[model samples]
Target: MIDSHCHITDKRYNADEVVSTFAEDGLEAVVTIGYDTATSIEAVRLAEKHERVFASVGIHPNEFTHEDSLDGILPLLSHPKVVAYGEIGLDYYWDEPERDVQKRKFIEQIELAISARLPIIIHSRDCDGDMLPILKSYAPRITDGLVMHCFSSSEELAKEYAKLGFYISFAGPITFKNAKKGDIIRAVPDDLILAETDCPYLTPMPHRGKLNYPAYVRYTIEKLAEERGVDFEYMERLTTVNAKKLFKKIVDFTGEKI
Candidate 1:
C-alpha cells in the first residue's frame, strides 16, 4: 500500500533494519519529509539510495527564519526520487510565535512548489483564518497536486477540498474511536480519498504510543474499510490507485506496473 505522507528521513526512524523491515509487508514506500535545509537535503539522499523511499522537499513552518531557507530546497527538487514539496504549511500548534511568519513561509513554499510543478504535502493547524482561503490562495500555482496531508479538519473542510480538486489524505488519527476521523472517511469521496501514516507521529491504535512505521498502515486500512463498509482489499486497492494517481512516480520507482 502507498503511505502517501510519512517521514522516513526523520532521525527517529532512520535505522537500517527499521526502515528496510517496515516495507517488507504491504508497505510500498514512505515519503521522506524535508523539515529544514539540512533535513531536506538528507531526504533526497535517502530517496536516491532507497527504491522504496521517495522525497518531499520543503522547510517546516517552524524551521524557517529567512526566505533564504529555500536555498537548499530549490537544488534538491531535481533529485530523481524527490516527488513533492512539503509538510510545509501554517502550524499554530507547533509554534505560537507569530502568524505572519508562518503565512509568509507557507506562501514561499507554495511559490517554490508551483515553479517546480510538483505536488505539495500540506500541514495546517489552528490558524485564525478560514482554511479554504489559505489553501485556495495557492491554487493558482499548485497545479492540482496539493495533498492535505494528515488532514484533521472537519467534514465541511474535507468537502471544501474535494470541491477545490485537492486530495484529502487521512492518517492514523482516523482510527481513534472518538476522533470524528471516521466521519471524514465516510464524507470524502472515494476518488478524492488517500491514506498515510505520517509516521513517527500519528501512529495508529494498538501501537499508539510507539514509534510509527509504514507496516502499521494496514491497521488504518482495516479501520477505513470498516468505516466505509467496504471489504479491506477493496479499500486498499482504492487507496493504492488514488496514491499512484497523485504521486505518479511510485509506479516508476517500484516498477509497480499497476
Candidate 2:
C-alpha cells in the first residue's frame, strides 16, 4: 500500500523512525507533503535519504503570507524526489489569512505546478464553493494531474472533481464510525482513487484519538476496500496503481514496478 499524502516532517514525530517502519508496516511508498518552504526542504531531505519516501512541495493556504514567495519552493520541484507540488489550496476554516490572499496564492502555485509539469496535492476546507470553480478553470492546464487530499466533501463535489480528471484521496475520516463515506468512496473511479494517512492529524479508527503515522494508512485503505465492496488486497493494489499513475515520479525515481 502507499500513503498518498502525509507530513513526516511535522516535528511532532521522528521522521527517520517513521520511514524506518515502512518495511514492517507493508507500505510500498509514501509522499510526504510540504505546507511551507522549510518543511518542503525537510521533505526533500527525507526523500533523498529514503528510497520509499517521496516529496511534494508548496505553501499551504493557511501558511500563506503577503511576503511569502514560491521562490524557495520553486527550486525544490527540480529535485528528482519531488513528485508533486502541493498541499496548497483554500482553507476558509481559518480566519487568519484573508480569503482573497489564499485564492491568489493558490492560483499562483497552480500555475507554477503546471509550468513545472508536476501534479498538485490540494487541501480544501469549507471553501468548496469557490474551490470548485477555480479548479475547473485550471483542470485543462493541469495535465500533470491533481488530487483533492484527505477529501471530506459531499458526494456531488467528489464526482465533480473526478469528472475534471482529478484523483480523490481518502484518509482516516473514511474509517470513522459515522463517516458514511461509502457512497463517496464508490463515486470515485477506481483509476482515480487514492489513500493517505495525513498524519499526525486524522488518525484512523481503532486509533482515532491518538497520534497518526504513515504506517496506519493501512486502516484507511482497509476501510476503503470495505466501502468499495472489494477485498483488502485488491483495494491495496488499486490505490497503489492510482497513486503511481498520478505521481509519476515515484515510478521514475524508484523504478518501482507497481
Candidate 3:
C-alpha cells in the first residue's frame, strides 16, 4: 500500500528506522511530506537514502512569516524523488500567519506546482471558505490533480472539491469514536479515494495514543474498507492505484526516482 501523505521527517522517529520499516510494515511506498524548508530538505534526504520513500516540498501556512522563500523551496523540487508540491494551504485553526499571508503563499505554491508539472497535496483546515475558491480558480492549471490531505470537512464542501477533480485523502481521524463521516467516505469515487497515516499525529485506533508510522496506515485502510463495505485488500489496491494516479512521480513500488 502507498501512504499518500506523512511526515517521516518530524524528528520524533528515526528517519532511517522509519524508511527501513516500510516493507516490514506492509507499506509498498511512502510520500514523506514537508511543511517548512528544514523538514522539506530532511524529506528529500530520506527519499534519497531509501528507495521506497519520496518527498513533497512546500512551506506550510503557519510558516508564512519565516525567512524561507519560494526560491529556497524551488531548488529542492528538482530532486528526482520529490513527488508533489505541498501540504500547503490555508489553516485558520491556528491562524498563525494571518489569512492573507496564507492565501498568498498558497497561491504562490500553486503557481509553482503548475509550472513544475507536479501534483499538489493540500492541507486545508477551517479555511475552506477561502480555500475552495482559490482551489477552483487554479483548477484549470492543476492538471496533475490535488489531494485534500486528512480531510474531515462537511460533505457539501467535499463535493465542491470533487467537482474540481480533486482527490480526498482520509487519515486516522476517520477511525475516531466520534467520527460520523462514513457517508463522505462512501461518497468519494473509487478512483479518487486515498489513504494516509499522517504519522506521529493522527494515529489510528488501538494505537491512537502512541506514535504512528507507515506500518500503522493499515488500520486506517481497514477502517475505510469497513466503512465503504469493501474488502480490505480491495481498498488497499484501490488507494495504491489512486495515490499513483495523483502523485505520478511515484514510478513503482520500488520508489525509483523519476
Candidate 4:
C-alpha cells in the first residue's frame, strides 16, 4: 500500500523513524506534503534520504500570506524526489489571509504546477463551492495529474472530481464511527481512489485519538474496503495502483512498473 499524502515533516513525529518502518508497516511508498517553503525543503531532504518516501511542495491556503511567494518552492520542484506540486488549495474554515488572497495564490501555484509538469495535491475545506469551478477550468492544463487530498466532502463533489480525472484520496477520518462516508467511498471509481494517513493528525479508529503515522494508514484502507464491499488486499492493491498512476514520478524515481 501507499500513503498518498502525509506530513512527516510535522514536528510531532521523528521523520527518520517513520520512514524506517515503511516495510514493516506494509507501505510501498508515502508522499509527504509541504504546506510552506520550510517544510517543503524538509520534505525533499527526507525523500532524498529515504527511497520509499516521496515529496510534494506548495503553500497551503491556511499557510499562505501576502508576502509569501513560490520562488523558494519552485526550485524544490526540480528535485527528483519531488513528485507533485501541492497540498495547495482553499480553506474557508480559517478566517485569516482573506478568501480572495487564498484564491489568487491557489491559481498562481496551479499555473506553476502545470508548467512544472507535476501532479497537484489539493486540500479543500468548506470552499468546494468555489473550488470545483477553478479545478474544472484548469483540468485540461492539469495533464500531469491531480488529487483531492484527505477528502471529506459530499458524494456529488467526489463524482464531480472523478469526472475531471482527478483522484480522490481518503485519510483517517473515513474510519471514524460517524464518518458516514460509505456512499462517498463507494462512489469513487476504483481507479480514481487513493488512501492516506495524514499522520500526526486524523489518526484512524483503534488508534484514532493518538498520534498517527504511515503504518496506521492500513486502518483507512480497511475502512475503504469495508465500505466498498471488497477485501483489504484488494483495496490495498487498488489504492497502490491508483497512487502510482497519479504520482508517476514514483515510477520514474524507483523504476517500478505500475
TM-score of each: 0.93, 0.97, 0.96, 0.97
Per-residue lDDT of model 4, residues 1-258, tens digit only: 899889999998889988888888777899999889999999999999999999999899988764477889978988988999998999999987999999999999999999999999999999988999999999988999999999988999999999999999999998888889899998999889999988888999999778999888899999999999999999998998888888888987656543
Which lDDT tens digits does candidate 1 get at residues 1-258? Answer: 877877777667654565677455866777777788887888788777777878888887877654345777778886778888897888887654477888877887788887887888888787636457878776765673888888888888888888878988888987877876677778888897888888888999879988998778888888889999999899888888888777766767776553
What is the Cα-based lDDT of residue 119 in candidate 4? 94
Q: Per-residue lDDT of 34-57 in model 3, one digit per residue for the tens? A: 998888999999888888899999
What is candidate 4's CA lDDT for residue 207? 93
Q: Which stretches of candidate 1 lie over 4 Å from their true place?
A: 65-68, 94-96, 128-130, 256-258
Deviation in Å, model 1, residue 63 alpha carbon: 1.1
Clashing pairs in 3: none
Steric overlap count per candidate: 0, 0, 0, 0
Model 3 lDDT on a 0 to 1 scale: 0.87
lDDT of 2 by residue, 115-149 (tens): 99999999999998999999999988989999999
Write down the worst ten-residue block by lDDT for model 3: 249-258
- lDDT for model 2, please: 0.91
Q: Regarding TM-score, does 1 or 2 come out ahead?
A: 2
lDDT of 3 at 19: 80
C-alpha lDDT (0 to 100) for residue 84 of candidate 3: 95
Evaluation by TM-score, superior candidate among 3 and 4: 4
Q: Which candidate is the best by lDDT?
A: 2
